[model samples]
Target: MSVDKRKTIFDKLLGSDIKAELLIFFHRNPSFSGSLNDLASKINKPIEEVEKAVEDFVKLGLLNEVKHYYFDPEADKELQNLVLEDLTKEESKSTFELIKDVEKTNIEVLDKLLPDGFPPSGLILILSDPAAGKDILSIQILCTKIAVGRKGLFITLDKFPDEIRDFMLEFGFNSSVFEKENKLVFIDCYSPQVGIKSKEKYSEDPLNFPNLSILISRVLKELNSPIVVFDSLSTLLQKGGVRSSLEFLRSLTGKIKESKALCFVTLNRRAFHPAILAASEEIVDGVIEMKVEETEGKVENYIRVFKMMRRRHSSSWLPYIIDVEKGLLPKT
Candidate 1:
């Protein structure tokens, strides 16, 4: 039986430097066959340890062992390319001079909006009017982060996990692959309150602020530099009241910052009072606002950076349109 390549590679390939060296050697010398002792001496590792690792790889169909072990050229070919590509990228990075410490969200418009890209541990709030596509934009940002080899935690307050997954698939993002690799997680706060049993591993009542915070903290601890997206904060404000929601935001942002992660929270600008919106904005590191206007029976969407702490951004509302394949795009 062939072992799951994605699972094995994600879990074990980076388990140790020894495993990496072994895999690299096998990939580079696909046709090479050697005994356990020979392979151990080649990589300068102990025969006992190498033999165990080699057997594990053989079981995973990465290697074929008849008289001696050799790389299985046809085994998980796609994953093999991904592994090699990732390893090559690491090697290339080692040769280059580091430019900035911030992680790129991989969104083109952001390059113009945030000149420095997204700073680690920054909490960004997305405020939009009804049907302005804030939820779609947030998910796109999350998917973008995941595409760039970062993990993401999406806390769904207004939608089902399945709906989110379907949306991801519609945009050509494979949510299943991300979930299987443990790179994308969904906290189904919507399901429990809707009286539908959640299929997610992490879930809590949306109204239970304390339990929700604990659940989020536990998941955040397991991820590294993850991108977190709160579908919409309006649900929190409605369910927990303005004061409790503000307190939760402060606590959650602090936890996210401590983890050195990035979080994007969504909110409906018209859902609460102006004073409440001002208070909410105070808790965030930056704010991006979106709105739609109908003129002469034609409707258009626009987005702008309302406030970005310590960063220069274009406050001018730029026109935008949603594409079926691309979640959101700057109007050309």
Candidate 2:
């Protein structure tokens, strides 16, 4: 006689066999998106029965209720792995765990703060002044990730695509190479705002929050866990106002988390109300702050991690310099 330890664990965690079965089904088919009827047909169960089971899982935090039911990306990892281990017993190891590995942010200084890289669907918020090197840091992150064969989606709220590409060239990142590979995409919100039709395939008015959300959702669906950047989210706040901008950010962050994408959003510290800034900071997984100060006629750049949830980080301010060719460099 043998005891099924895995089954015991699953039963204790889920408390029901149908819930355990659904967990395995969703793990094996992460891309499954259909109605209850469709899922019921595939699972060989009654529609009513399947709907009740799925509703139960959703209420229990195991499933997400979108247009269709799917496994929640933010679900408990240890419990998820335990359920998946039983389902994938034929394999030598679970591919689910491999796919869940953290994606590294390749910036040298920032990598030191985020030693474990980014957790799945990590949301980072950047607060800095115009001259504080925030944009340069973002470009460096995008370029490094793209160089490593990861896809990137740049939401340009403050610059044209050509201007951004030129800026990247100044920092020694050849954006054209990644653009040619179709692994890099730009949403030219800036051009549309200035009454100029953007030549880029994706362009939307910054004030049109719904359309911007739709465009981002479409782009994210085409790429697998790409790095998404909102260069100067302050433009959105300036144009849309605090209430509308916060609503838009809530929707945007929800989409990013559900897609398991790494997102970096930049906000100018001098632009919006402090209350809005505080609210924005509350919505993200981490916040990195930068400042520029002049002392004795020499301007210096400083950065620090203000807050990072569930990660160990040094909050001490670090001196750094923006190199014309190499982007951001730690001051010696």
Candidate 3:
């Protein structure tokens, strides 16, 4: 007779096919705690193997042994009740409250880029090639919101908060005033990478999607009608794999929609996989594509609206100039 060796879901979780099967059996028959000989017979395994697996589970804190019977201590009533409470709790807001009027939310540079103003509550993707002014444009858009008395949250994955602050100051926008007034907040996702402790709401591990989601949620809950800027999505795509990055974006967008806040996420067009880029574009409300052109001896920057959902937008690419004194200015 040949023994079966098919992998099960528990096998993946426990890293041992036989142990996973035993765990499943125990879970199914929660009250059936038995001796090693009985468990070995029930699972059709050697008594020694059964004993080893049981001892492993006990060491891992998944099971407990009392008077020669192994059982799952996590199946206790108090823990079960806590899990049920989490599963049954109602969300703070409904779907209808998430969607907002796109016409009323006005972003300064965005208004000039799109025929209509910024959307009220959705993700906006900004794509550009390297050195194409994507970061500068995104910062200018954020500063525009801050200048208009709207709260802004900048999640910087590629640059330190001080670097971003210096850039803003060099471009003639004083970020200190906004920081002092508590209108601008920065979630520093880069400082920890270089052995430096972050002073802001720091994410020690940027690749941890659940941690990042929780941090963003807590911040958004405290603010009202804010503009959230993800400095660059490409960094996240590199840190986390494609699937995890996509899942993170989906969850973040859902939260942004729920809060009725505008989200601006930038991506380096050339750094991402084609499939990942397509997947990201599908989730956003609008897309702004930017590029640089060498004309004669000078480099010129241009931008255009690639797509805007539920709004009339210009598809024509227009030339733009970055002025240190005035920020981004549309060339006449």
lDDT string for model 3 (78-101, tens) is 333433233223111112223354
What's the best-to-worst order under lDDT?
Answer: 1, 2, 3
In angstroms, how far off is 11's CA in candidate 2?
Answer: 43
| Shift in Å, residue 84, candidate 2 | 40
User: Judged by TM-score relative to the true structure, which candidate is superior, 2 or 3?
Assistant: 2
lDDT of 3: 0.70
Q: What TM-score does structure 1 among the candidates reach? A: 0.68
Q: Each candidate: what lDDT?
A: 0.77, 0.74, 0.70
Candidate with best lDDT: 1
lDDT (Cα, tens digit) per residue for candidate 2, span 156-238: 98889999999988877888888888899999999877899889989999888888899899999888789888987787765
| Candidate 3 local Cα displacement, residue 315, angstroms | 1.5
The segments of candidate 2 whose C-alpha lies over 4 angstroms from its true place after superposition are 1-104
Output the number of the TM-score-best candidate.
1
Task: Please state the error at residue 227 of candidate 1 in Å.
Answer: 0.3
Q: Clashing residue pairs, candidate 3? A: none
How far residue 4's Cα lies from its native spot in candidate 2, in Å, is 45
Please identify model 1 stretches exceeding 4 Å from their true place: 1-104
